[model samples]
Target: MKKLTALALGTVMAVSMTAGVSAATVESKDDLKNATIGVQLGTTGDIEASEYEKDGATVKRYSKGSEAIQALLAGQIDCVIIDSQPAQKFVENADGLKILDEPFVEEEYAICLKKGNDELLDKINGALEELKEDGTVDDIMNNYIGDNIGETPYESPEDVDRSNGTLIMATNAEFEPYEYREGDAIVGIDADIAQAICDKLGYELEIDDMEFDAILAAVQSGKADFGAAGMTVTEDRLESVDFTDTYANASQVIIVKAD
Candidate 1:
């Protein structure tokens, strides 16, 4: 009877071990409960993925979303959680990567500025509303995303006045479509939108590219007038900075190895 008991216990232990291994295979969202998730530091994805840590998952953060994708490709991470648009850009440029059809979370993108800068916030929000009303905001976004990408580039009004001075924009340029480097200039949807806002408000736009985590600090320290790297408005972030009205809707998505 003792020998039979030992054999049954061994079988039970083997089954448990197999189940543990399968838990991290990551076929879908449920698997993330036990998988290692990669995310860009200080992003919505990082915040969202941290929730899974309580469920036995590990969250690994990188300075850039592309770096997280690289880690996923290297087998160092089970999957990546990132903004859907940047995930699409990464997946299209690389092989063996795919975004899950079901989004991880829905979010809105907005411009952030120093807290209590209500005067500037009101002006920016007003300008943004005007842009949206005239269809300029849609043109700016469609220029960088969707089938009309690169075909509907936004242009500044001819010889627009800039009497309000220059407003420096802090951003992490590694996020494609929204913001990224092209040649020597940082050109993307946010860049153009900032320019449009400046054009409306009479302030010349000056963008300062920096690490994602530093954007808020830069704006708070008065180093940049505003931060707009596809920034999301969260209650946590709202504690430190003020945000303009939301300009665009976005999603957090999962990037897994292509099947």
Candidate 2:
């Protein structure tokens, strides 16, 4: 009876330990090797997450980051991979969601133009260089996301020339801090940057909000002058469109349940 009691107690302890381990959330990238990773469709996060898909992991793509995050909350996915800036927004709004300390990938954000559109690329690059030199780029980013965030909103430049009619910008407005709707206006970092570029180039800026996956296609198809939704340049994208000089830095991060 004594031996049987000891054996029963050991069994209980083992089961308890196993349960604790199983209940623990992802704490490291390696932990994701066998996990179900959620990502926004056609995003760099989605592209990067594909690498792990071969490692016994599954990738689930949502049209919006919010949808992927919702799936995470509903227990439909083990984790979400998204851009760091928008990840902060989602993590702040959702209880029990936390970003891992280590980032999955670091990337530069740039404007996507139609392939072979060297003239427009040169103009954008030149304007970006000037904006960088004058600190306008930094100011715009701080206004939307940095220390000065939300204190002062961006106002369109009145001095810009509209002779060129409009420079249509393609974007996914669902990504906050990058591009998102405020009231009826689509406004954010990318919008401000596009505006600044248009101002320097003497053109009116117009934004078209659509799925992230379609932004590139819109630019390629001449439906939009450029794509600027926190877009990252990849070799795959390069094959389809030309990108301007990098305008901002971004990272892909993993979001998991806290503790």
TM-scores of all candidate predictions against the true structure: 0.90, 0.89
Q: Would you list the clashing residue pairs of candidate 2?
A: none
lDDT, residue 185, candidate 2: 84
Which residue pairs of candidate 1 clash?
A: none
Model 2 Cα lDDT, one tens digit per residue, 194-243: 88888888898889989999998999999999999999999999999999
lDDT against the true structure, per candidate, is: 0.85, 0.82
lDDT of 1 by residue, 30-58 (tens): 88988989999999999989999999999
Q: Where does candidate 1 stray beyond 4 Å? A: 1-23
Question: What's model 2's TM-score?
Answer: 0.89
Question: Once superposed on the true structure, which residue ranges of model 2 sit more than 4 Å away at CA?
Answer: 1-24
